[model samples]
Target: MSTVDNPWELTRAIAPRRYVNRMIAEADGVIRSNSYPSKYPVNGNPPTTPWAMDLTSLDGRFWFAAFDLDAKTPEAFEQASEDLGVLVRILRDTGLPHVVCRSSPTGGFHVWVPLAGIDKAVMVQLADAARAVLPTLDHGMLCNDRTGAVRPPGAPHARGGASTVMGGADDVDVLRTPTVTAGDLLRVTAAFRELRPTVDPADSSPTGPVDARHRAHRSLPAWGEAHMATVAGGRDPSRTGYLCLLAAAVSGWTLADVEHAAKTAPGMEHYRTRNRPTGGRERRTAAEAAARLERQWAKAQERAVLYRYAPEERAQRDLTELTGIVDVVDAMLLAFTASPGRWTRTEADLHDSTVLTYLAWLSLRTGSRDVAAALRSVAIATGIPSSTVDRSLRRLHEAGWISRRRQADGPNAAIWRLSGRFSTPGEHVGPLHDVTARPPAELFDVRAALLEVLEDRITAGRHDVFTRAGLGPTARRTYESLTTTENAVHTVAERAGLPRGRTRAALASLRRYALVVVSAAGWRRRRLDYRTQAAKKLGGKVHGALQRRELQYRDERDLWAWWQDHLIRKGGRRGRDRVPTTQAVLFRAEDERGGPEAYPLYPCSSDGRADHQAAMRFVRGGLLQDLRDLELAA
Candidate 1:
């Protein structure tokens, strides 16, 4: 019987696809692979077993594509981009009855679960469980470049660059050792484990033509030339998942032959190809994205400046993030800050229990400041070996946030100091001992700052809306009481219990006509600090250049108009005691003898000179602004 409707359909259908006998044929470049599960048929049996697994990525863009061995579309990859919230919500609420794994993508996350581990009935159950759980997602805010921070688009995607986003078949850095060992195999296995994130092994390789289907898809020279950031923490390239080996290759087959296995297997060619890259409108849209990044960077920097209290002369009165910083640099800061607190270290576990205990004990001993000091004293007094403290301190010091300040007189013990700014994220710090070092977030410090910003915004009613935008309840009340009950800046400052010194200063900042002002004595307080028409934001470099270009163009226009007007009003060389205003306007004789003649208007010359030809065009153009070519071209 044909297997379609049979309970044994999946088993019979999936059997000859790749497996031979009771064993599965190894691909050309596969180093390690756990058993993949599915449902299938055996002989004429009513039921059979097959295998399957599904995965998701965490780099922000969401997907929940699945692979079913029984179907014609085994490695078919389909995405639910805007429905990220819906899919993740489904997985979170209605747990699947299968073994699962998770991976991180550039934007969001992914979930990996094997289908064979759970029976088809349970899989159906899982789907039913999620029927009520998936929420409708509104992704209007999650469009191109709307993330409100600078993200590198990666060098404008040069001609013939990789078109599709692909991951490695495995994330293994290959070895050049003379001798192979069990240690090497384990390391190799761990490396490829990361690459399974890709739908195709090509995902782990370069963009151009693939010589072999299942071969290790790595191009080292290409990587070097492109200057890509492959892995976090500067992992050694060889140890990276840029390459993989085919551990299960059939004996006696050439490497070329083995690679052909994956060529037709799960992931073949799936990337969509358009007629061309983009449109003219797309170019304009790209610019808009670039503009938004500039704005967000500026805003984040403006915040930094406000936090730093930069003076008005240095401060731009815009919605920018910081004051007196380059646009891109400020962008980086905002992008980093938007992540909020650093990535915290995983919870203490057996692998690091000793280290955590040692640190905990050390925290107590090293401090003369209250608890820390008391703990340190107890550790030292109780005869906990000083060597243990030394080792713990060494790792902590290496983490950068902590430093060892040794005394010259020398009890010879290390005095570790935490030199981190609260703003200095912990994700950057906690990675010291991590095989893959990454910082741990210091939640306390970050949460404190967030609270301060939220409280005031809530109370003021200034924005008129706050909750959806993230203002705290206390902030709302403070805004209300300050405006309604205490109207004057000083009075409001008093009622708000602001520091005396800061209150006056902050009031001064708010009171400037361009800044803010409060009206009413006590009934209702309204804010008056809004942007003036002249308050435009531009980056430091481009700001000056664009402004200069505008000013120069304006001056030239005025000069041309003024010369015309002067001839009209005074006529040529009238017999009067005129100050020669037109001549003075054209030129001042400090540097040159003759007015106007010293810098005569560039005359149109259709002669052989290139400069003259350009001048002729400009003259005929009537000093047009060329709104078409202006950087702010409409």
Candidate 2:
């Protein structure tokens, strides 16, 4: 005596399995499904004997609006029957056909309204109309989204409860109402649709007077785009549920609005949550779900408002006030190359150097030695990828050249303050790489002199040797590190903010290109000790240009006699002559033209002997490697 002639449907009604003859325990709880399985168990394993029917998903698209009643004891069954009598009277008034069946032996009834050959939406509308008439019914079940759970007649339930038909049809018609046609139900459904609350899915933004500029044209926020994508993905309805709830909370939408939007969304009906159990309890009602969603939404909003908006964006200082700072910074950077010592070529990578240059410029512009730099914003400014910039900045921090202070719960960029020992001056001074200690004040003086000379060289149009070297970003930065001092690989990488492997690779590339030479200093604990020196050919083009300029000055007697004499000076055991130093040869004309006081290219170092030795090695050892390439004989 089944509605359809499918034995599988009757078997499904008897089984405890949820979907496709398999019981499923999701976040919502245990569900018995009657949907067809894509593949059945094989290799001697049989499918579940009986599966619970998913009434809403059965063929013919007829919707099942079930009303579950609990009586507990035999005596309580009387009240349940009385309640069903009241419900039947209400349904009879609407002329809708229905059934009354027993769910468990202990006494509970499932009064189901099966809409014949109608769309599920229409069925839900019919259920809503029925629910409206019997508003006081405790266990009212509305199958709006086709997600509710319904056990088949004669199925097994918890607590030794066996389901059976109580009354309906000719076989069982105790308290049944007059059966109505499917067309009559459809007509009633069409009428219910008019009464349903409607909300635009796209119009969930917060309610407020739109700004004049935004009034003419409106667009969703970034978060809204993310929310819609999450909903459409349908991977997890729980996440979507929270998102929708939060959206509603922020936009001041009611539960009805959320439901309407969800109902209208294509494919959203497949997300069944209503009949699922949470925490071993039945799924929440529409109002309960809304309230829970609202609480979470409120907490999130509070956290964001308190922590996110408290701090300002970037702190902008007036440019006018930073005039002196800019000029001083510009002078230092420009003169850095001209001043002697191991300071000219920092050997910093292009990205790192570029980042530093920007930081320097910002310090000048912002009138603060400490600058706030965002990796993304910095990448955009420097034309480097954000990932690369991030690596470079990490390297910079490790090198102790810069100090970083991270912002706490703010949109402000990480705060970066130039190293006082290098930028300003204090106890920590002298050569950044020197093992020997020197007075902080004295070291600062030496560094200042070098920077001033570098500035002069820039003004005089000296070529930047780093650019002419044609090295990769990391190699160039590593090369600069090598030029500074002989340090272990880890030390160099740490100083450069590069990975150890990257630093090693960069060294190999530099050696391959003959930019620098690495010599084994000694072996310590079986590890080969290494020391690197810039190849004399490293500054090949600049060396050639300087040589040519020097020759022109020497040939022109119009140049000052002392200058000519100085250029022609000799020093050896037997008074043998040697070429002038690189700086002397390069800067003589500029110095002569613009006086030593104004163009201080070579400031006297406190330790002249040491400076002289460094200069001699720089020209004769480092700079002399490419004498042939410089075309000195030509």
Top model number, TM-score = 2
Worst 10 residues of 1 by lDDT: 272-281
Alpha-carbon local distance difference test for all models: 0.26, 0.42
Model 2 ranges with Cα > 4 A deviation:
1-51, 58-60, 70-79, 90-97, 133-141, 168-182, 186-634
Report the C-alpha lDDT of model 2 over 1-634, residue by residue, as the tens digit: 2232332445443222234333443466543342333323322233434334444444435444567655544323533554455455445546666666677666567666654344554454455443432222332244433435555555555434446665332222222222445667656544433322112223223111222221101222444434433433232233333444444444555545545545433222222233211011134456554444444344333222222212232333543334334444545454233331223234335455566665664564334666677655554444344576688788878977568876623334688865544334337567767644433222222223333222222211222223333343555455444421235677666544566777787777655645544544210110111111232345554334433443333333112222222333322112112333344333422222232212111112677422434434334343432432233323
Q: TM-score for candidate 1, please give it.
A: 0.18
> What's the residue-level lDDT of 604 in candidate 2?
28
RMSD list, candidates in order: 27.0, 31.2
Cα lDDT tens digits for candidate 1, 263-381: 33222111111011110011124443333223323332222222221111222233121211122222322422243122112211111222322222223222121112122222222
Question: TM-scores of the models, in the given order?
Answer: 0.18, 0.23
Location of the lowest summed lDDT over 10 successive residues in candidate 2 = 522-531
